[model samples]
Target chain A: MPAERRARPADAAKVQRWLDVVAALLRRSPDRLTFVELAEQVPAYGRGLRSRGDERWQESAVARMWERDKDELRALGVPIGVYPDAGGNRSRYGLETHEFYLPFVHSLDGTPARRTGGPPGVSMVAFSPEELAMIRRAAGRAAQLGDPAVADAARRAMASVAHDLAAFDPDADHGETVVGQPLDPTVLRTVGDALVKGRRIRCRYRSMHRDVTASRTLEPLGLVFQLGHWYVVARDPGDERLKTFRASRMSAVESLAPNGAVAPPRGFALAAHAASREAWELGDGEAVTVRLSVAVHIALGDLPGAAPASAAVGPRARTRAATMQVRRLEPFLRWLLAFGGEVRPTAPRHVVQAFRDLAARTAATYGAGS
Target chain B: MSAVARFARLLRLLPKVADGTPRRIGDVAKALRVPAALVREDLQSLAERVEDTSGGFIEGVQVLLDRDHVTVRSRWFRRPLGLSADERAAVALGLAMLAQEGPAESVPAIQRAREKLGRLGPGDAAVRAGRIGPAAPRTAVAGAQRETRYLAALQQAWVARREVELAYRKPGARAAEPRVVRPWRLVSARGAWFLIAEDAARRAARVFRLDRIDGVRLRSATYEVPAGFAVEDVLRDGRVFMGAGAGTLEVRYGPAIARWIAEREPHERQPDGSIVVQYPLADDAWAVRHVLRYGPDAEVLAPARIRELVLAVLRRMV
Candidate 1:
C-alpha cells in the first residue's frame, strides 16, 4: 500500500476531528480557510502552536490531506470545491454552508416558559426567615439525595436566589414556609457511576411497593429521579433480569465478584432488550417488543430532539424511534401508565389489550364507566 | 405501516404537554404536508382534551388567519400543592438537575421559575440567609448527559424491536472501523455504559460500549424479540462485560475507599470491616486502572500471584 493508504487508519480520527472542526467553523463563518488560518482556527490546532514555529507538512502529505478532504466533502455530496486563490502554492478552502448548516432558531423569547404559571395577580409570595432557611436547606438536602444532574440544578437554583437576594425582595410574603431538598453527593455519585459504567453492582435496595430490604447484584443501566425518589434500571442477578430499583430505598451495598466470565449471547443488546417487553421484568426471561405511543405533548418531550442531548430530559429519546422492548410486558406498561393517556401501545396487540384490561379493572374498582 | 408510522409505532411518543408555545397549526400542517383544515382539526382535537387530573379545558388557543399564526394555551393547576420544606427542596433540586441538559432555552425557564418563587418570599437578607447546596461540578452533569443519550438510544432501539446498525470500536483493537449490528439492550455498570446486541455480520449478541458506538441506525425490519430474552439474565449468566479473565487479581480497601466500594459493590464486605473480591484468570485484562482506584486504601490480600500484581501497581503509583 502507498504511504498515504498505509497511514489512513491512524490519521482518520484526527482527520475527522479536524473535519468536524472545519465543518463547524464553516457552518459558523462560511468563509475560505487558508492553510495557516486553518491551523489557527481549528480548535485542536488553534489551542497551541500559534507561531507554527516547526510546521512539518511534506508536499506529498499536503496533497494527500487535500485529497482526503476532497473525498470527505464529496461523500457529503455537496458541491464543495477548493480553489487555489492566487498562486499554486497558496490555497483557500470554502464550502457553502446553507446546505449543511442547521438553522436552530429559538421559537420563544427569554421570558419564562412557565409550565406552572403561579396564580394570577400573585406577583410573588414572601416567606419568614425560618421558612426561607428551611426552604434553602431543604433544597440543598434534596440536591444531595438526587442524581448529579438534579443536584447541580438544585445548586444553581439556590445559588441564583442567593446571588440575587436583593432582587427577590424576600419581604413580599412573610411567615410562609418554603419546602426544598438538598443534593446528596453520596447517592448521586453512586448511581451516576453505575449508569456510566456498564457494570453489575450490589445494593441494599428498597422497593417503593415493598419496604423490605433486599440485597441485589444489579447491572444498573439507567437512572431517573421522579416523584422525590431516584430509580435505577438494574439487571438483578438473583433472578437474572432488569428491574427499576429506587435509590432512596437502597440502604447499603455490597459489591461482588464480576459476573462469571462468559460472553453475552450473539446479538444480545441491553438497550434493544430494554425496549423489548422483557426489560420490565425483574426476572430472567426472553425478549419481547413493547409498542406504545406518547401523546403529542409528551411526544415532543419524550421524542427525539425536544431537549438538548446533554440535558436530563427524562429518559433519552431514541433517535431511531419511540418504541420500547423488554423481557416482559407487565412492568413496562406499568411504567407507561405513569404518563396516563399520554402513551399508548400500537403493536403487540396483546400488550395494548393488557393495558386496557388493567385500566378497566382500575376503573371498575373506582366504579367508573369506560 | 409507512416508515413514519412504523417508526412512531415502534417508539411510543407519550405527550408531556407542559405549558409551552404550541406549534403553529399551519406549521404542523406544512411539516406533515397535510391540508390546513386537517391540521386545524387535529389542533381542535388537541384543544378539546381535558385528560389531565386537573380536568381544566384548553383555552387561549390563538389562530390568526390573517397572520397565519397559531398558539395554544391552557391554564391548569396540578394538585397536592402544599409542599413541605422537604418537597420544596426536592423540586428545587429537580430544577437544579435540569441544568444538566446543557444551557438550553431552559436557562431562562430556571431563571423565571426562580424569580417567581423568589417573589413569593420576603427580601429580608436574614430570611433568605441559609446557604444553598453546593452546585454539582458542571463537568459531571455534562458527561452524564452525553452518556445517557447513547444509553437511551440503545434502550429505545431495543424496546422498539428494531434492529440497530452501529459502528463500534473496542479497546486495543488495531482498527476503529465501523461495525454494524442489531442492538438489543443497554446497561450501565461501574460508571460505564455498555450495549449488548447482535452483531449482524457475526450473527451473535455481542457486548459493546455506548462511548464506542460511532454511528447508530435503526433498520426498517421489525424484529421479534424472543419472548423469553432478558438483557439482565444474559449479563448474570456471565455473558456480558466479562471476557475470560486472563490473570488472578486481588486488591484491598481502606475505610475511606470502602464507602464508594460499598456504593459500587466492587467486592463482598465482611462483617469484620473487610471486603473480598475474586476474578477469573482468562478473559479480563486492561482493567488494572479500575482496580487501582482504591489507591493505598486497598491492598491485595489473597492469591499470592494477584497480591504481587497489586504491589506492582502500588509501586508504579508510588
Candidate 2:
C-alpha cells in the first residue's frame, strides 16, 4: 500500500538528480571526474558547495551524501569505478558503459555484428531459443516456490530477459511447481542476507533427532534444499564443526553485528556440502556397509551411492547383490520396507535380523485388529 | 520510494517508452505490476531537468505525458540492466530444482541455459556451480525417473486437452486398475508428482499419485477443463487427498517426536507433552500408510475405523 501511494514532488526531484548524475558520468566516461567537479556539475550536490557558511563542513556533508548515493547505485548493479586522483587527495569516479549496461543479445544464427571496442560500445551475448525457454521455465518455477523474496528475484530476472527477446513473454503460463513443506519466509530471508553478507547468525534450533531446543551461534556457509526441507549449512563457533539445521525448525533467527562476521575458509565448496545423501546417511549413528539382494528388474543406476557387490551367482539368479553404507538402521529399514519384497537385506546377520524384527512387529501391530 | 528503487524502476520503464510510441499509462502500469499513479510520478521525474552550477540545464529524458497516454523520445537505457547476483542465484537454483524434479525432457534445456548463463562472467559462473544461493540436491530417490516420465506424458495430455487411460495402483492393492480420465494438470508437491484429473467413469476430479500410475495411454477423445475449475479445489493447501464426505481424524504423537510434528502442522499439546492433531481423512488406506510411516511414535486416537484399518494393513504387511 505504501508503494501504491503517490510519491511526493520532492521524490521526483531526488530521482531527477540521481539520473542527472548517472547521465553526466556516462557522457564523460573513460575520463574520471573528481568529487569537486561532479559536485559542481550536479545541482543537488552543488547547492551545498554554493553555500557561503562553513565551507569545510559543507564539503564534508556533500562527500557523505555522495558516498551514500554511490553505494546505492552500486547496489543497483551499476559498476562505478573509484580511482585516486593524481593531483590531489580527492577521489575520481567513472562509469564504464559496458559494465553499466546489459550486453546486446543475439540469436545463435546471427553473425557477430561488431566487436566489443567498436562504436556501438556494447558486447554481444548469444542465446538459442531452447536456452531462453529453459530460463523462462526456471523463473516460472521459482515464482511458485511460495517465498516472497525468492519470487521477487525470479520475477525481476524474467522481466529483464524478456525485455531483450521479443519472442519471450514473462507472463506466459508455465505449470506450477509447489513445495508442500511449509517454510518460514522471514527465517529464510534473514539467513540468506547473513550468508550473502558473510555475517554470523544466532537462532533457537530444535534438533528433530535429539528432540532438544537450544540457542546457537553459527557462521552460515550455504543453504541447501533437500528432501522437501531447507537446511542451512553452518559452522558452530563452539564445536568448530559444520552442521546442517533445517530452516523450518529454526526460530528467532537474528543476524549478528558486523564485528561478529567471519568469512568462509578458503577452498570451501558449497556444492560438496549440498551433494545429495541418502536419508539413512543423515543420522549420527555409526556407519556400516550393508549388502542387499535387489530384484533384477530394478535398475542399479537409480540407486545413488550403491555399488555392485559381486557377479551374479549364475545367469539364472533372479536377484543381484549390491552394497551401500548406512548410518542409521531405522530409516534404512523403513526405506527398504517401502519396496515390499522387491528388496531384501542379505548380509550382516544383525541388520537382517533387525529388519525381520521390525517387519514382524509391524505385522503383529496390524494383526491386533480393533 | 527510495531514490535507488525509483531509479531502478525508471531504468526498466525507459526501455518500454523510449521507442517513441504512445502507450497507455494504465497499460504500462499493468505490464509492470505497479500503480498507475507511481508510473505517472516516474514519467514526470524522467521529464524533469536539473540546473547545473554553471547556470545551464541538463535535460532529463524527453517525454510527452497526457491524461491517459505517454511517449518518450530518448534512447537512454534502452536495454534493461543485466541480471544481478541475487537474480542469477534465484534463477540458477530454480533451474536446479526443476532438473531434480521436472520431466526428463527439460534436463537438456536446463543444462544448456545454465552453461550459457555461466559463460556470462565469474559471478554467474559461481551461481551456476552452487557457490551462491540455495542449492537443490543433485540426486533423487529411486523410481523418481519413472515418475518424471509419467509426468511428461501427463503434461502433454493436459496441454492437448486429451483424455488418457491410466493404470493406477491404490495403496496395498495387488494390481493397478485401468481408468480413463481427462488430464487437468500435473502438480509436484513435497518430492512427489501428482496428476489431478477427472475420472471418466465417475465424472469427478481425482488426484492420482504419479508413482502409483503404471502406464498412460493417450486417447483421441478430447475434453475441456470445466469452467472455473481450479487446482486448489482439489489440492487444498498443497495437500493431495481431499475427497468428498471426508471426515476428521485425530492422531497423537509421543513427546519425543511432538515438536517435529508440530513444526510441520498445527496441533494441540497435551499435558503429558504429547500432541494431538486433527487431519482430514479422505481415504482409509491413505490414513493407514500415514500412521504406519511413523511406527510407534504415532498412534490413532480417534475414528476407530481408521485404527482398525491400520492394524489390518500392518497385519497384511507381515
DockQ of each: 0.02, 0.31
Using TM-score, give the best candidate's number.
Answer: 2
lDDT of 1 by residue, A1-370 (tens): 2342222322433433333333433443456666555544443333333323426432434445545555443332223435466676436665443322211111122322232332332232333433343345435444444355454444433433332133333122211111212334465566554443344567776543353567766666555543233555566554554465556556555434456532234564443443321226545677666655553333233432222222333444432224554666665654454333445565677877877665444333223344
C-alpha displacement of A337 in model 1, angstroms?
46
Deviation from native of the Cα of residue A118 in model 1, angstroms: 22
B1-318 per-residue lDDT for model 1 (tens digits)? 122221111111101122345455466565334465644533333333222212221122222222354553333211011111222334454344444332354445554554445332222231233111111111111123333344434544664667777755564342356666666555544334567667778876666766555567777766765557565554531224434435555555655446545543447776766676654433222343334333334555545554444344333212
lDDT, candidate 2, at A189? 84
Candidate 2, residue B156: the lDDT equals: 63
